[model samples]
Target: MAEIVNLRQARKQKARDEKLRVAEQNRALHGRSKAERQRDRLIADKAEKFVASHRLDPSGKDEQ
Candidate 1:
């Protein structure tokens, strides 16, 4: 005996699975924890301060 399957339901299920897979990948790539965000912010702040400290003034005098 041959089994009968609904093609429309199968297509929808496949699409749903693909969507979930993509969503999971996106979460892994783009999601960040609170601690991670804080660490990134701290690193950026340090870099900005370091650059500012080393930057020369427009009048060619080192700004203190």
Candidate 2:
């Protein structure tokens, strides 16, 4: 015995499944937690501060 599948419903279900797979991949690529985000932010802030400490610019350049 064979069951007839509704074409429209099957297509929609496949689309939904594909979307979930892609969303999962994205979550994996990006860190998935608050702690991870905070850690990255701290690293960036420290790097910026280090750069600023080593940087020098003419004060009048910004006024132009």
Candidate 3:
């Protein structure tokens, strides 16, 4: 005798597996660690400050 499987249960299980697969793929592509995000933010802030410091004043005069 051969074993029998339920079609509905099989379909639901397949769907769940497919959903998990896509979730994992998305996480690999878009997920970032908190430390990584913080480091990138710090780098951006430093670059912005450097540019602002080097920018020339159009009026050629310091404003109080």
| Candidate number achieving the greatest lDDT relative to the actual structure | 3
Candidate 1 vs candidate 3: the lDDT winner is 3
The candidates, ranked best first by lDDT, are: 3, 1, 2
| Candidate 1: residue 50 lDDT (0-100) | 82
* Model 2 score (lDDT): 0.85
Encode model 3's per-residue lDDT on 1-64: one tens digit a residue. Answer: 9889999999999999999999999999989999999999999999988877787975557988
TM-score list, all predictions: 0.68, 0.62, 0.78
List the candidate numbers ranked by TM-score, top first.
3, 1, 2
Residue 40, model 3: lDDT of: 99
Q: Model 2: which residue pairs collide?
A: none
TM-score of 1: 0.68
* Residue-level error in angstroms, candidate 1, position 31: 1.7
| Model 2 per-residue lDDT at 26 | 91
| Weakest ten-residue segment in model 3 by summed lDDT | 52-61
Q: Can you list the residue pairs that collide in candidate 1?
A: none
- In candidate 3 the C-alpha lDDT for residue 37 amounts to 95
Q: Is candidate 2 or candidate 3 better by lDDT?
A: 3
| Candidate 1 runs further than 4 Å off | 58-64
